[model samples]
Target: MKKYISLFLLSSILVITSCDERFEELNTDPNRPGGSVFDPNLLLPTATFQHGDLITGYSGPILFQSMWIQALASTSTGGANYYSNADKYVASPSTPNYIEGNWNVGFSLSSRLNQMQILAQQRGLNNLNAVGQIMKVSALSVVADTYGDIPYSEALQAQQGISQPKYDSQADVYNKMLSDLEAALNSLSASGDQLRNDVMYRGDITKWRKFGYSLMLKLGLRLTKVNASGAQSWVQKAVAGGVFTSADDDALVPSDEANGYSNSSANALNVPDDIYEVRWSKLMIDYLKNTNDPRLRIVAEVPPAGLAANRNGLVVGNNDPAVQIGLPNGFDLRGGSFDISNHPNFPGATGSGGDVAIIGAYSRPTAIYRRRNAPVFLLTYAEVQLLLADAAVRGFVPGSAADFYRQGVLGAFTSMAKFGGETVSASAATAYINANPLNVSSANASLKMINEQIWATTSLFANFLEAWNNWKRTGFPELTPVNFPGNFSSGQIPRRQPYPAGESSTNGESLRAAVTRMGGDNWITRTWWDGGN
Candidate 1:
């Protein structure tokens, strides 16, 4: 009996060994390549979606940039003030989590894009490689714009044994971005096969090319203050290369409520906590109302109900542009003091009751602003036209600045109709453009007008970070700095955000060196292109 059991055990062991030898082969799906092989098509969608998520996500634009630009204001006071730190410019001991999250998202996407580029190159897929390069440029630009000096040259070089990469100057990063974009534009051909999972342009190589050139135009405009000659050269190159001529070529991320791929603004601001706490800033509301801008009704909503009703239940407001009132920045719910009599038409609580009056009287964003599946515009034809207007004003491109400016205004209204629903018709857009035509007489005046228009056009779905950067570069719209107590920058708007604190422990030497080179790792420290206050 012992001999028979030993033979059975030996047979079982042999059978197990045989199965182990063929295990990987049997489990591997022939349709899907496992392990080393990567499909660029599959990777493209991930990069694109992440890029959209990062730009519109709370971490990147909605929370910081939008507030910085004064397009949105926080109503929370005391302990419950969620974004009070950002609004008041109170410097924490370390970088905010959202800023760090934005940095990580950009670099992570870049790393994946690097892998996609290598695989695409090996496969002789030029268009795929170009797309990867374009994405890499876009991702790294966000990093540069956010933190000034960052890991650029040696970034994502883990395969080459580079764990701790040194920081590169913002100028170098911008130059490299331009070069990579130019190369991408050159590599893309009409004959090349279309991308399988392109979310921005479907499979249209022409639109892709236009998007690249438009991005180049934007980057070129960023250097206007720091490197005027360089800015002109690149702007001219972008104009000659061709850019988005119409709304059809606009780079937008389509939203789907079913799959949880919704608009980032709605995701961040539509929640009950944020909806009641966040309202339109006095600056944005005043500007639109004063200009008689048709977009006001689409962007803002009136106060919900009477003071008693508001306290009982959170009843929403009507979408009347005339009744909208923006909340002033630098005031918390308890600290806010407004003249209630000024807004007799306001449906919310009247009289002077501090938090109740301020919170219940001021206009919050409209439902369109909080729509679940509203598409987020990445880069639009309006932006391209505005950039061209700037270039033309600077004598870098042909055509009158007024012409491009008018086109920009018209394009912005037309594109924004998507969010405004059926109410914002083409005739309404044309009428608005006609009413507010570019009437500046001189170049400097034209620049100021153009940039101010750019500011308003970029307020809603367009990239607010770019608007903040534009404000930093041009000093247009003339925003007054909030002088809250315990503010970080001596009551001035911050020039750049601090680097993440984790870098001090993980990449200590490089981070210290960057801080030293950048003067200090504080918010007041300006980037290479800021040209100081």
Candidate 2:
């Protein structure tokens, strides 16, 4: 027994010694530099990806409504229209709290753009990387416009070791943006393996070149009222270099079942009754109804109540919910269209459909619909031709604006199918052309015709950002500030969105400096162009 106890005690002692060593090993000495996954490139793509998402939503459908609804062309079938607020006189966060959420989302995107630019420059020139630079400018523009002032000259240098960036003046930023876009346009000529990452163009340098040129045109046009000389020169350059000749060439972000960006924007706009609630505004409906445009049929369907057998002919204004068609633009009192139906009361799930709408809401608590494939439309042939026609009409270019206008119409018409939108065939194009011939051409028509066409295209196309940008540039179709109605007691349409609140609080000093130089950052604080005075 004594011998056995001795052996057992010794074995236990050895076992305890082993346990001590193992424990010491696991308690890792905090001495060595452990594996830190802090690669900039790793975070870069994620930022870039978010860039398209956040910017597209804020600028596209969200702000686009400000223009369309204010123009009285479209409305909130569900109060989803910005101009509906104008019509009803409601102060919205989209307006007042424009800069509230996700400034980081954009800065995150900007950071990525910054990194890509450096990577491309460091690695030498390639079309793919050059496109990255172009996207960088695009992303930054959204930041500047939204916030009034942005970190341009010194921004996005974290990869290069920039911690806190100073703000760049709005004017100077615009200038730099134009310069960057111009370079991006030139960079489109990069050959060979460089074109591989040109996802938008599929290794097509010519298309990238055109995309860059078109962006230049867009930038130039933005300065139309601010710097006619600058705007005119760039527009001429765009025409000379060639621009997006078709919608197929647009830099659209495609959506799908798994990833839909617009869904976020749409959710930020949900109305009561679980519906999207936006539809044709009075101005749009009037014009369409007056012209008897066929497209109206494709874009809008009568409300469920309006489509019911008993309410077959019920006009939109009728109160019988079952027979109510979508309200016209500026009509809100009677609930309008139903986006989709959801039966929340099925089983254990809480009662469905009493969703509280929150503006600038990022979580998009209500957006569960499958994400759709929507390519980001960088530019389009119709837009290029329109710029040419505008320049020609103004006598800024050599060619006849009339011819360009006709081409633009045809080109714009062809873009429909490429965007995953409704398309009319060559036959229809010919018929439309023959019926409305170049005996006048598309461009030389009355400003009303030319402008209306642009507006009509804007209304039908899914490229809401393009629509908003175009409106900002040309102010065509005279979508007089919806503030014109009681909504305009202050009498102004928001020219740009405010800086995201996070940036202001975290990066306050620089943001303040930007605001001071840019005129209090008020809705009335016009940027460079806006008719130049």
Candidate 3:
């Protein structure tokens, strides 16, 4: 009886101890995963997709940069007057919200990447950590470029009690980004732990390295105007470290429409105003037409004759190069003197009566761009080659400028197929390159040609923000600014977008200090790298 009681007491003590030890764990929800068990790889795709989507979405790039650069022109007729913020440099009701778009999106992406990197570090995942670093640079670079100074060195440190982080000057931002990018690129290794759920490269370390270097080269080029020596150093390092050599190396994130991760630019363009009122700018089309560029047919389409047909996204338009006409920028549909119909050499309306389409004859972006699942291009071999061409022309490197130019032009043509569009034939691309050779006469002439091609290629790729940035740097393709009434930039092309309105209340001191250094907070004030100082 004594032995039996002892055995029962010991068993009861064990049961109570076990229950006490696992009390919290047993009550915890299995569906809610803790950070310890979560995979960092999942953050890569989300950051990558959001980066592309936010930049290309309706708010900033679509409503502002795209038209500001005259790549796409809109009439802003009827209820689509928000487009005037882009088309005429006139503030719209949504301008306040739109100006903050990139700032907000960039920081959001940075925060996710920061968490991913911290987690990666804790696990000793070098490749994941390096990738996170590279992506962070890419995201924050856009922010610094858009706004003169932004939260950089101290950004995304909320857990460490850094809610109102100081804004780093654009120059400091660029310097740090270049250094960090270089370090991250060197850290990536093939023998490292296997990376999973990679949406861009499928864990290919080589391609990621190339992407990093390519991005570095772009950043280097951006500093050419303000810091030429620094630009040369970074460009040299990028080339030596190995940049993208082919379209296969392009960093394109795939969109899954069925899974609700559709392309945002395409979605924005499908809106009634965007589909009907928006058309390819005359400057863009005329350049292609005059050069007999093969992309004219692949990118621009004239809608079928009628208003209904033009508005119908399903109706395929005439893609014949000869018939495509581009709409002149800074024009409107309102019947006052500024009406597009009143412009010289206006293509006549396509239909009569209720079916009449005033802008039907003008070219719209082709169906390929409107596809919801089209891949978003982050960086491409074509852009890298074009930048190399410029570098070579400026004696920043030893390579032949002409050869790089040829590669760039051909790569640009070949890259079009990635849009899910009609592929430009290799023979045709070769023919175009052969016929139009790079003019290696004077350094200035070569520089102009190279940067102009950059503008054209970037514009076609729907990277209008980059296109604008390059234009600001090189002053190439010499665009004429619209002097519409109540313009924001005093009849000049805007150099930088104003900061988000919330910055005043949240980080007012930092914001005011940065603004003081920048001269003003409005659009015309240049960034540090843009010759502000």
Candidate 4:
């Protein structure tokens, strides 16, 4: 729960900053290492060097999670964690609000990645290189996915002659990512350095390689729609070349919590939308309760002071004057939304609430955040296993579906153990297998079991990105879309994040080009990878 909340907060800060003038002020970095933004001398780069405007003795979880408000409910979180002043999920044409602001965060990180890539090559720091490139590609991939056909040709060239880059097609961006990943993996392998200062791996080269391969597979799998063959080819290549074998080797960035968690905003705001009532998306909560999954205690926390808990499972999105409960996504209670007058169930005392986590917050000794040294994982072997299980059923790849399924649960349990929590008893895993074993043919039955487990286990492992991805891909467990009486369109799960409002003013031509490429940027228009009816 800590890491999940931390990620949300991290993203909120990044997005809210969104290249604003005050952004530099937030970063009070004390270190001053010179020459080019991406100097090769600094092999193990810190946030201060890359971002310059940061504080020292303060760890940088800011670069940890890339925030993308993919849905309308996005504002609830932004309002709480980012702006710290917003009372409702309201945005006007003038400010464009937090959801739109996140687009800038993703791009800013990508720009840093580009800068790093150029400098590494120029200085022959090939040994210390690929990691930067890998991160850049990963960040840029999200940007392209969120806002199709972004300013690819001209982006990240402040040092170069171009400040405004032309938008590149999503297709081209994918092509570049694939090419860059391939090159990065090979480069890291060929150039051998001690790699002594890795926060993610504790200087483990093998783990980094696995991380790259896993990311490679994730990127490939996203194209499973129109490019099934291509997706398959990449998946196969990644598997054959080797990917993560266990969750411990997962890729993550550690938060610098030396200051009793005061230095990082993301670590501080770990609750749902920062307002607390994470109203168990009927889809999310029901699945665990139904399966008797024990991972539930780790995510939910009571609100700080006011709002009561929606205990009776007050069906979310239910906003009828006649109906008892449930409000639409982005429905402001201050407004006349009848369904959202106040939380009725488990609301916590003042400031006691928390957000959902990417991985388990209830690990053995203490939660990951309490460890004071836990890292933010980018990907893990457990996710790969779940994917493999999915593929096993689909016959897209060769493996025992049941075996892969079982391993995923066990591997996930093992990974969760490292986060200062109780080890998942083997009996529990066995019992789950007996009760909800993989049902090879009945896709929904097998998938529901797999995905629910994945969600439970990967709670602290992946952040909002994982949740959004699953919701977008399978629509399993079926989260109820927030029902707003005043919604601009039919109440449906939000599909893609809106382009940042700044794009309209700063990079209008490229932004419009992206919208044109992606069905005019409507909320309903699907991403290239999403293809469920």
Best by lDDT: 3
lDDT of 4 at 345: 40
Q: State the lDDT at 181 in candidate 1.
A: 94
TM-score of 1: 0.87
Question: On residues 1-533, what C-alpha lDDT tens digit does candidate 2 reach at each position?
Answer: 11111222233333322231232332244542111311222223233345556644443344444344333222232134443443344444454443443355556556555544444454554554666677777767765655557788987655356656889877788899888787767656644444432334546677767777777777776776777788788888877787776666666544332422233443333433223234344455455455444344444433322112112222222222122123333333233221112212111111224432211010111112112344444456776676666766666678775677678777767765554434566876766655654334443354446556666665455445455555666665666554323452366555554565566676788878877877766545666554354
TM-score of each: 0.87, 0.71, 0.93, 0.73
Query: Whole-model Cα lDDT per candidate?
Result: 0.74, 0.51, 0.83, 0.51
Q: List candidate 2 stretches off by more than 4 Å.
A: 1-51, 58-60, 63-89, 92-105, 159-162, 190-192, 259-276, 306-331, 334-371, 419-421, 436-446, 483-489, 531-533
Better of 1 and 2 by TM-score: 1
Q: Write the per-residue lDDT of candidate 4 for residues 279-308, one digit (tens) a residue.
A: 223233444556665444443232222233
Those runs of model 4 whose alpha carbons end farther than 4 Å from true positions after fitting are: 1-95, 259-275, 301-337, 340-374, 418-422, 455-462, 531-533
Indicate which candidate wins on TM-score: 3
Native-to-model Cα distance after best TM-score fit, residue 198 in candidate 3, in Å: 0.3
Instruction: Return the lDDT, model 4, position 443.
Output: 71
By summed lDDT, the worst window of 10 consecutive residues in model 4 runs over: 357-366
